[model samples]
Target: MFVSRLLDFQKTRYARFMNHRVPSNCRYQPTEYEHAANCATHAFWILPSILGSSILYILSDDQWETISAWIYGFGLSSLFIVSTIFHTISWKKRHLRTVEHCLHMFDRMVIYFFIAASYAPWLNLRELGPWASHMRWIIWIMASVGTVYVFFFHERSFGGRDAGAGMREQGRAAMTCFFHMVAPNGKQKAPGVSPKPQTPDSELAAPRPG
Candidate 1:
């Protein structure tokens, strides 16, 4: 259905023009073409993730991050494609606004999970001194809380003023900080309080006098 419309929209010049035939909730507001463009942009991530996974799989066999990297690629690819499809559908099916809005929430719910899942292997497996052990767990904890909250408040978030957009942005920011804090970029920082002294392993790896 949507796949066909996406293809047709490209072929037909008239369909590409701006219009207001979409739902009020669609991020696709102001113009129909903008909606199509957003969907297409997200859908574009699908192929690159697939190809990236295949390439990485061929390059590394036993590395845990390699395995997780594959999972990350495929998992996020699906999230992006699904988001694109339902976002399009939510716009196209103007009459089913309520149902479509719910569908959009489900789409976002997957994203909340995927963010944690995809980051687990990469962030947790790295040698981040003391932080590696629980960084992934912290992310899962946040994701778990988010999943439950999103499901329970699915309607209110969608229907209430400033509900959907506000919560999504704030939650995304807060959850992102959890993983980013543990980034192995070698930056100094704290998780719960002041940064802990580097573990013996970090001390051993420190550069010796030149």
Candidate 2:
């Protein structure tokens, strides 16, 4: 009888999960279990991300490389940490509106920094022409502008937007970064000269002296 009752409960929980629908408005009030699950998604990665960042920092060969690694590491780890904290608070302390709102704002702000840091290693470590070099600094400037926008205008601008608008914003940002990263550097190889093959690691590693 106990086993049968447990099976029925499991079926009911599964049904609720399957029937869940996202509201039209941007405000999503997840159930306690959903909030815990969301928190776990980011919290579980915090340790591994930190360990990976530490490894990259230790593997860095120069001062600039170390700095890039540190930037990337901080961005990656902070994203997860902040997300975990925010979601945990949302789950465990739903009544704390003021604290939750502050954390929520911080959570959004960190994402811009994280995006810029993701590009840092590749931009700083790779050998590039003048255009790409300029982008190295430009990306940070863009991130700063984005962070400022989020801080000063996010609530006022996007507080009433629907889920689709939020998705479109994310898509636009991703496309912008993609084009910047893949844009031509205006360098042409000599006739009959083969370019060196590039691996993922090579793209992020500091350029070796020729």
If scored against the real structure, what TM-score would every candidate get? Answer: 0.58, 0.67
> Per-prediction count of colliding residue pairs?
0, 0
Candidate 2 whole-model C-alpha lDDT, 0 to 1: 0.72
Give Cα distance to truth, residue 58, candidate 1, Å. Answer: 2.1
Per-residue C-alpha lDDT of model 1 across residues 120-179, encoded as one tens digit per residue: 555534444554456556666766666666667654444554334643654464444444
lDDT of 2 by residue, 1-210 (tens): 878777664367466543345555346577666787889899999999999999999997677678888999999999999999999998889799999998988888788778778877766665545455576677767667666766675555456753235434543554444334432545443222346777788567868779
lDDT of candidate 1 at residue 175, scale 0 to 100: 49
Q: Determine the C-alpha RMSD for candidate 2 after optimal superposition of all C-alphas.
A: 10.1
TM-score, model 1 to reference? 0.58
Which run of 10 residues does model 2 get worst, by summed lDDT? Answer: 183-192
